[model samples]
Target: MKREEFLKRGLGSLGLFAVIPALTACLKDEVNASTNTTTSTVTSDPTTTPSSCSVTNSETEGPFPTKSPADYVIQNIVSDRKGTPLTVKIYIRNVNDSCAIIKDAIVDIWHCDAAGLYSEYGGTGMQSVNLTSVHFLRGRQSTDANGMAAWTSIYPGWYSGRAPHIHVHVYNSAGKSLLVTQIAFPEDVSKTVYAQGVYASHGQADTSNAKDNVFGDGVTNEMSTVTGNTTDGYVLTHTIFVKG
Candidate 1:
């Protein structure tokens, strides 16, 4: 199928069946860092609780080994509404092992500017916007001793067809990619944006996953998390799993 048709059908349905194995091979080059280990924890919010949807099986094991944290690059730094620079932490792990620790994983992240325009891809609708050669909103970060990596970037803006989101690529110690996913915002932002007719056609922005063809695929809520406040842009937090 053509590239446009494939994207239109969504990444999950694309016939890149053979590409999955090749993608996993690219994550073998991540560098592992040794620091004070931190325990993994989950937070609960009564207002934004996730529904009973399983995007990816948290039980699958990964295909690569772990490395050091110093070998990766951390990027996309920005300031919050309080003027405090808040760096987002990202983690690379094995797709199968829920708790398998892998260090030195390389992560490449990119997203639209504050005005909802991507840097490289064309035909996103905003043609007048000068998105070319502007890579300010993109960067790479590696995991630390605690299997956590962070980035400094501004909150992404909302577009007409989609809700606010960030794109992520997770690689292993050998620079092999393990997973490809997008992080979404909390329901609070969705409610406001949807009410304003931003994503109304998608059936209420707050409940986009159920309607968004891309998000409806193998992607899961556990793959990412949205946090911070929307009044001052937003802060999205997600962790990638790597195997050893």
Candidate 2:
């Protein structure tokens, strides 16, 4: 009887020893998976706000701003002023959140044409004198489901002084403005873009982003990331975060 009991006890001990390694491996795997999940989602969490919100830099409205009311929003701002087909896309985000896309935001964009002429402005380089009625390269669109507002436009021409830039204004649903900023381009890209098309006449911008009065202080947040070339056109994208 004693011999039989000892054999049964030895079998039980062997079983426990075998199960222990499997259990340990399973637990370790679960812990590793949990750690990886946390690491992957850290940047995407909306609750993790930055120490300081990266709000879009406020910039001057320039000399030729449209007096059009807020309700006069249009998706296509390019109008008659035409050149290489460039598209401007603005992604709106909440400053207090973790750059989470905010839908239904209003975005207004305006800029000069390849001739350094503003549609609504009348001056030395303008196509028309006192051209307040024109509305080229200017329009407004609401952010879509992905918090993006896009406009089909031409590559802007540079004049003697100012760097090529697009002026942007973002407003909330209640018509309260969240930000006013300018979108700058990379020096090499801007130079290459201006080398051809209608932009070639005036050549590259004499005033670079560093030298530009408005873009001097705050260009890091204002600069745009461009994809594509002058022949096929370019897509300019910038993200703007505003008051939460």
Candidate 3:
């Protein structure tokens, strides 16, 4: 009887030893899965805000809307105006759907030169210098398949009663006005740009975004992402969503 009991006890011990390794492997696998989940969560977070697909805010076309925007449908709008070079890229998305790219949409952009002066409109109650015929810092382009229209221009300067901004007018393929908006610059970046070279002579903007007539309501949907410095120039990118 004692010998039989001993044999049974030994078998039980062997079974436990075999089962222990399997249990340990199961626990390790669970831990590995947890680690993978945490890694995925961290990687998914990005610094830039993902496009929200909401319609952009509509703004005034401003006093200096290009007289004949369709006439200047060229990519390089730099003309004779000089300042820190800026590359403007606008992405047009359809808010009526899922904010998908809207191809063949017309995008018109215009801004003041380094000295806080516009090309076409001046010499009046609004402006003092006469430049009625000169057309610079203004152009229009159709969006590509990716819904992007790009232009090579210069960093815009600020005038009194307004902050540094870019005016945009978007139209559908059939010439219907979709949205008119303005792009606001980051104050810190504008300060940095204004302190250098040609921008230095004119000084900084007199008005702040929070105090401006158009942006005072808010700039959450109109602000642009500007990268680079005064030396190498800058790139301005903004996404505009319209009903389409």
Candidate 4:
């Protein structure tokens, strides 16, 4: 999926809940831009957004679609797409129950490069090239037994009228789509990460989450708890709840 804005971390296991492992988030205290160092610990603090499956709001799929554009499934989708390192963690849970993880579901992710250009398509503004033969920050995968999927890509860049975000698609074993949505990041975190170069030339993001037409309603369960800095690479996590 693509957005009027742009796209789409990693996760670790914590505890047991309802016979399933409870999801926990670990965020770093600070990020050192120069050395890229950080400190982390598991936390269930109020600031963590997707700590449990509360059913994130379904979002609109933007213009560029990779379900048919992307060639296959890949775990590390950072082929020459430079920028701050970002690991995206996706947890799929059943909305009808106590957020049970849904195994065997296919998850697809796509977003702009550090320069804010999308692959497989040409555009104006920040992106001015056709990437039909190029595959940068695009990947697809199936959820593991824990109902979790992860991808290693750079932090997404901004476009117009939208905040910094990522797009996600979940498909059943039969390839039927179950969820279409996007994940958001905090404004402060975006500022800190972008300042380390890479996306600095893009200037400040033109839109805030509140001003963003897509996430303006408030990110709520769709926002991720970002830890680590651009130096140490960022680890992001979010839980997606879909109908069974």
Candidate 5:
């Protein structure tokens, strides 16, 4: 998902950097970053090769995948859920086609709330919370011409065995499944967000990304670039590279 060259050359050529921040601002209650700090680029880790256009890592969608995805095709997934505000911005690119933007791609995302509870499934031997009737923190969006799908959600809380993560399932324009993956948050950012508001009650995640089964290999492509803080909320920008 290398985009440094494209952001500098492609976006700069079309003068899109000036408008990307504005587009991110249109989400209203999603983020509160100043114009100077609101960027729509992937701030890759220096330890990884940022220039490599490789496919994003695929992970399990976890135990609670949406049973009816069509019913939750909206942007704001915060429906009654509470936590530190978080805006997730995902960009889809085609690795088979020279890392070109993949438009009209349907992207679905779901995660746990501040209390480490997922909607639609619980009350069982596995979860034991009884949230089968509610549907929060789950929704879908189609990618725009710029290959971006944004969502207004809250920062996810961690459970015992897994680190805080967002599950993503991508489909093509015709509704063919392309990839099922997960997005990992930066540990420092998660620690900062968890230390505030309702999240503080649950304490930090028991597992680190390096020890988690899904991310134990590496998170070079799955890690998100998170900005902002507990007061103003956080903004996570990540890129998913698929064949399309």
Candidate 6:
């Protein structure tokens, strides 16, 4: 079955409605940044637009709501391209030192389509893959009573120029962004894609954690997973902390 279809069925079978109320209570109210010194809004061309995916202190849209992407409903399990089922568990925390532990932060995640193309971006020609009016492979889940959250999703495909990774955005109750980051897989899996010549040289397909420009920021190996090769495929676990 397609990943999207699998998620929908899984969520329905799990009775996710029973958990929505508790999850919603954990989010925080929106707050403006205290240190902003400028108020200029400029629109850039689509092709030149910067990546909205970031973990730094940047302003973003809000009203903190629960938005689940199309194929997010598998149990605490996921299957890779080879159809092996893998169990996943993610621990989330408050990473920002400025804020207190985000008691009820919200994490929104998304990724490229199975063919390794992002819906909003223009490069990938497979337009039919758009799962929703907005996009597919994207959704939101709230932190638990302990500031941790987990989900089961397939190990994403490797797109040209980038390693197999998952994109995440963290937000406080007020709908302000706390961080934007991508969790990467281990080098062995990463090298598998690179060796296939899927990405062009200009894309820096061979860059490692020490060399990748974005990952050069203050991220740690502790934030990602590197093991769990089960009969179903690989299991990837990652954790993130949000500071209120």
lDDT, candidates in the order shown? 0.43, 0.65, 0.73, 0.69, 0.76, 0.41
Query: Per-residue alpha-carbon lDDT of model 5 for 1-244, expressed as tens digits?
Result: 1233222222123332311211122122332322222332348442232467888887887899987765566778887776777888888888888778788788889999888999999988768999999988887777888788999888899999898899999977766688999999888877766666777788899999999999999988898988876666788888898988
Please count the clashing residue pairs in each candidate, in the order shown.
Answer: 49, 0, 0, 11, 2, 21
Which lDDT tens digits does candidate 3 get at residues 1-244? 2322322222223321111111111001111111111010111111233456688899999988887665566677777666777888888888787777888787889999878888888888767988898988887777887788888888789999999999999987766689999999888878877776677778889999999999999988788877776556677778888999
Which RMSD values do the candidates have, in order?
14.1, 24.7, 26.7, 10.5, 10.2, 15.9
TM-score of 6: 0.51
Per-residue lDDT, model 1, residue 34, is: 21
Instruction: Encode model 6's per-residue lDDT on 79-182: one tens digit a residue.
Output: 22122222234445443443223444656666553355453434335433443333334455556665555554444554444445567777554445677667
Q: What's the TM-score of each model vs. the native?
A: 0.55, 0.74, 0.79, 0.77, 0.81, 0.51
198 Cα displacement, candidate 2 (Å): 1.0
Best by lDDT: 5
Preferred candidate (TM-score higher): 2 or 4: 4
Candidate 2 residues lying further than 4 Å off, grouped into runs, are 1-53, 69-72, 123-129
**CA error at residue 160 for candidate 1, angstroms:** 2.4
Q: Which scores greater on lDDT, model 4 or model 6?
A: 4
Q: Write the per-residue lDDT of candidate 4 for residues 1-244, one digit (tens) a residue.
A: 2210111111112212121121223222243355554423332232233445566788987877674522435777777666778888887887776667787777888888766677877755445677767766777767787777888788888877778889898876555678899988878778776676667777668899898999888887678777877666788877778885
Provide the global lDDT of candidate 2 against the true structure.
0.65
Stretches off by above 4 angstroms in model 6 are 1-88, 95-101, 119-135, 190-207, 216-223
> Which residue segments of model 1 deviate by more than 4 Å?
1-74, 77-86, 95-98, 121-126, 190-207, 217-219, 230-235, 242-244
